[model samples]
Target: MSANLLPSPMSDPIEFNNSIDLSDIGGTLTLAETTHDAWLPPEPVNTFEWLCENMHSHKGAPFNPVQFPWTKGICEAWDDPRTRNIWVKMGSRLGKTEVSLGCHACAQRHDPNTGMIGASTQRLLEKTIGDRFYGMMAKTPALADLCPPKHRQNSHKVSTRTFITYGAWSGSPTTLGDIDPKYVNLLEVSKWVREQKSESDSIELALARGSEIPDRKFLGESTPTIKGACRITKFVERASNEYFHVPCPHCNHHQRLRRNTTGERKDGGLMWDGGPEEAISPEKAYQTAHYVCESCHKNIDETQRRSMIQKGVWCGTGQRVDKNGELVGKPANGIRERSFNLSRMYGWTFTFADYARAYIESLSLSGQSFANDWEGEAWVPLKVEMEWEQLAKRLCVGDWELGQVPEGCYFLTCAVDVQVDHFVCATFGWDNRQRGCLIRHGTVDTWDQVREWIQRPYEALDGGSDMRARMTLIDSRDGNRKDEIINFCRSVNDEAGPHVYPSMGGNHGSMNLRFFRKLAIDADNEIGKKAKRNIVPGIHLIMINTTVFQEWMDNVMVNRVPGDDMSMMLPQCLIEDQDLFDQLLNEKLNKEKGIWEHIDTLVPNDMRDVFRYGRCAAEVLTNGNWARIPKHRPRQLPESEADRHQRQRRTAEQLNRNRESGGKPNQSKKRFVRRPSSTSSKRFVRRKSL
Candidate 1:
């Protein structure tokens, strides 16, 4: 969408868009014919109402401020006479950019005599207009004239009888200028430099530009980054620290949603399950995702997200909500500084499955990005290490053969750690809780044998049933035989299902929080340089966060018993295999470089690498749902056509009118009302693309 497709500021739909004739359609709806309603600011009003009525979004539609209940709290806070500083630490796609612009527009409507926006860099600061700010102004007839020149691009200033705004980035005080602005909006503060060229910090410099007027307001927001280094973290820590509270549709109990805290709260954050142990697929994992209520512990489907959010209220830390949904205590920071923390858990459009995808993608690295990007929390990177002797102690001594499955095993996974000369393979059988039994470990000299080994079923220690590998993950990180590894995996997958896959030991290039990402094969790599490439469609390499499994092994798995979730079990045969034990301790983390390296260069760490591979293979099948995955996954119905159409419908003139007038409905109580037409000739702006 561009500036030209923006909603017209005209109050009358006919005058706004003469292209469509509603008279011909009557009261019915159709595909070819749709609503062309437009809206504009009528007078000084509540910022939330103003945005919902007049402001156009980046999608070139009227704003839906109610989409996320948390957003409304921020918008309404702008009008609060008590608060001066309002901050929100937000997750991605939570409408931080739109809300920021709406507040600026609101400031322009009321106290917009002077305003400033500060960002991490000049590049980000200058993109405000091209991003959506200019389109927002150009869409409203009243604001279209108050701002934006002939086109809506990099608009610097909006000078009117009431408002003026200046763009500022990280720099000296000169960037803010000599004039004191009544409103200041600072974005991406986590990425901002701590200090400007002058003695004051970046945030202080931005806030210092605010006038000494009693009701002057400053807005700041960012997706939190590092734990100790984040600027937004510092700002939020000092404020009221508000959290969004929503009532459980089942229990009617209002509570804060803290993720993965089953024991601490009834709701266990975002919940999902892979199907049965043998049939789990990453593609199918998201379909079962849903939120678990903290109070009732019942599943909260995505359909309930909007309604629960609509009734949400902001409660500061240390404040609780009673059965009546009233705050039990005064706000932590009172009216001086109001702060909020928002995440996908509270978003209208987010599903539990969306987070399941993030969890899958985060398997290759430390799962901090999930906390930082989706949970709206700062993450502290862990410095992990493990001892070989300690891991050997957790080895389960059993009558099981080195090449056979254990007693309670349900499925098998094999991992091939490719070396320059040969492939070190480890076959592991897993229970539902991811407690592993190392079925076999050794070297395979040829690809033919490796392929046969992965397909063969191993006898169980209990002599019950034999199981073939559910998934075989082969390390393809080395450049030496990367092409061979990928080709072999692709051919095997083509022959069967996606049981065999080439694996990389790192974060996915796209996102950091997932356990694995089905990444596109690089068409320009050394392997792709060959002219005889037989790239299969829909066949991609799986980049597993080997570090996640590695860290779990070091910090949790190796220390726990077999009954503990995600614990590892080595066969008694490995007790005599001292070479495997030594190999496990070969790599240690280099704290200074943040990379793992061989403790002794001479020791072959194939067993260690293969151990990591087998665990990653388990994750490829399980997708990180080892803890508390629901057993029975019920099939859900496809969304109804009527619901889809209604969800996608634009704001009608009636709703816009009610919002524009602050919801003072006419005496008739009818669905439609007549209003006089105006000939402003206000044209729609194109949807601004940044």
Candidate 2:
């Protein structure tokens, strides 16, 4: 249960075997026996057997003993005194939380008086460790049996034990200061310690409180965050002081190994392509796999590396010694088990198929899956397929109107779609109040032409207008186009009247339906209110999916079965989305329901981008900072029948008052006068001012 205390009953009689197998020994050995025989048991000892034998619990017990196989790393850590902290950077579905819980339970069983702590992210601690893990304590007979009744205390907020009277405490990191722990189990170390952004992280709090408890230990484990500048890196640096040295086979010289910086070759060259392939099998030779040596330019054999290696435990800034008694720089603390460690335990006897089954069942229950619904197969095996076509007509429209040139038009916006060779530019015009069509040019604008187009109004304008361009929205989705687009937008800042805005919503012709919902709504609303202007002022342009739109118009099926004629019946011209089209084609028709159900639910990449872009545009348009003119305010008509009658009554009152006070009733003096219209068609008469 505790690090220093080993169960004697199971370990003392452990057979000396290099295989370290823990199998076929059930429910007999006691803790005292394990402690007696655990002193550096040689290979074939079946460490797995010894562990399982020691872990055998009484039948019909209130609790089940934590019965997972003891990893080599955990066993090695138990032996090393220098390794005050063991950091496990594991992958997903590795039972990290179970490891923490089982380790605590194991420690409790071994040493009833030893103290320990369990810490994780506050949210995880509450929802998972407290809620889920504690729930197991009640359900697991082995765990209940192992936990003495007096020591166990369960509650809604927490479930605690005093196994080794005040030896360990379990809580969130923030609460670590209150629980003085001898051994600390830091759960999800990446998220808890490495990914922390504030001073209040559990690691910091643990360190602060750790000094109070002398002779303390730490276990930090989680799936890696991968990103640099995380707490795991700091932990690695701190733990790097201890070295595990192995003798060189050729020279018989004991030398410590340091984990060299990855990606940089010893020759000062860089790895531009993929790094070394992952080692899938632990029994496979490690040296022969992908490692390179800087000393002799020779690769070491894996079998030899495994034979000569000792899992060395290191502490702070410790030095190493060679066979000649010469001092060497500090090296990495050699890991006994790494990525492939889990592969070894999969088929072992101690590996309960039931546990694995439960884990898989939990994942399915949580609505998690590794497979794609389409093809009824794994998602990772999903394939990419593409089709390309060109159409003469533009699929999307610009904002500018060529037939009617409105006066006092000041702002214009451009949306430029960048291709490998040429860019497609669509422009829109707005007067800070109303929006209209501007101009659209495709695959024709050279970089210079684009520059001029963005800087000033189109030369093809119907009137000789002097108003300069307002805003230009350029596309920069491609990493290659970023520099050019950014430079172009920056260059025309002073020349253009409006800001150069970069737009990222359109998905070219690749299933992009950026404004599908927004465009479908009728513009009409409450007429009494002033027109709501688009907040993101300037031209609204998007890369027209002319090909996809045409395909939709033609009701053409993309990769659909020839026998499936449902989507074929729908006209393609009105459909704006190819992803939707493809999705609909895969639906299964139920005659009884008279409806089609999707055969597979999958989120397409194009749809994701489209949603992202739509969200970005929505944020910009509805941010509530539209410009308004004080003097040229538009007249608002009243709403509601009662309000209209009230206005007419007020108008009558004003006219009667004017008639009573004037020498003669003036016909020109009318209340609530309407202004003259500018359009050529005199559709409505205007009343004179009162």
Candidate 3:
């Protein structure tokens, strides 16, 4: 407060610094220690400069534009008068999050305006705040007043000195209107989720919050999630899609850096020494990877790539630059949004070999992730499609009647879909030649009826013995009586072998490339351990990768794939089941996500699901060795109706006993019984209960 002494420089912006400082008159200044820029009058600078001067990486490294030159223009665009929105659709580990965070900090410190970071979810909001506003506040002393000492982080919102708050994704359209923000950041937008249908997506709502402010800035950042349903895709399409053009080391040609391992090296692609396409291995791809310049027709090694990328410039997709670094073609006019598409090809950490190896590995896995992660491109779906009505009309293949068992049926499998009040079930029969038929499709309500369906013996029409479903899979997903399904399967499995299993379709996150996986739901519960059970009983739910199997089913039907005796035996008897046909047609592959989803979310697709499950059951039984499946045996005398009734009674009684025993083996009891002695005389004898 004294005028005689020098005033203090800028205070702690992160946790709040109140230390006062003195000028040259206070003490002999030395070059050994640097002075705080806050002590002097503030100088004008762009967002990137402010970031370099004020912020440091989480690891305490100073921000350097030369090291990460790709971020220079992107950060500068935050203060561009002509640009209102900026989108960076780039590969992983390319400093997308850091740049967005840097811009947010710059807006709060340099401009002193209200800002909001719209994270994909509440968890990401925590990561943004705790990791910076709370976690790294001490390290970033220049931002002393960034956040409160004990941040509560209530509902993903934070109250700070500069009024920088955070918001979560919302579909209501009105949620983002809570507070007007001058700067907005849509972070990891591809992961955002909505409760239900909305008039506007979360990105649009978040962007609209700062639309009216003339000096507003918006930063949209994400990897491409789905082909057509991505937020970054919208940003890039509306803007001038720019590709980073690096000068070729061989010919000094400024061309867009790309990868192409398909053709010869002379054709100009990401050339590597994977000699043959079929024999290409990751090792070979990585050890001899190099980029062939389009102009020079020469290889650009990793050493050249590092230096060239530093001098590279971002050019619009439609624009071109010649070998002499001269503009050859003009970009489209009147583009408002500034967008950039980057891939791992330009990354500093990864060598050409590393990039090629990763790409090859991704191709072997799904043939899609490389585009999404490394190429930063949306996955384009290219596969077969089907017309359900047309397929249904061609159901007159062979005389394999639907109700009657197909001739020489080797094995049977049943799949059920649980409905609100009833259960939809389908049983399929398969022969040794891999020919399968849809034997029965109907709906039943009671568990007893499900047991009957599973246990019902079908006499093979080709003078073969009776057959029963080798395996039965029930859909226990979407909160649809999962516990009940497990219990029913357990009771049946206890009486029979491991023929029945509780199964469900897995979500994208959990489902792997495999057709099915067994997930142990009951890891600790040892209900039957005390009884020395035959097999340690535990709830191991079978999770089906419906996407994979369903896609396979579509290809099998439409393309006649796996066509070595693999046939979908259609019968005229099933032609009358219009509901089944409609349900079978209900599903369509969502090319955007590379998954098969229902065309109509509301309509019933139970029979279609049942069919898919039937296919899955057949797969589980066949596994890998088709030879393991025994051929149909010779015909035997069919069980009489009385014998069948007795067997059913026994099964029902066993199921009841198993349930009553609480997963333990039933105990025995002693009883007095009358025994025949001599001639018709009866005698009382002690006997154990059978």
TM-score of each: 0.57, 0.33, 0.63
Predicted structure with the largest TM-score when compared to the true one: 3
Q: For candidate 1, lDDT tens digit of each residue in 315-396?
A: 8877888767788988766768889898877776766677666655443334566777788887655543555565566565
Ranking by TM-score: 3, 1, 2
Model 2 regions lying over 4 Å from their true place: 1-103, 113-119, 126-144, 147-174, 193-202, 224-228, 241-690
lDDT for 592 (candidate 2)? 25
lDDT scores of the candidates, listed in order = 0.68, 0.38, 0.68
Clashes of 2: 69
In terms of lDDT, model 1 sits at 0.68
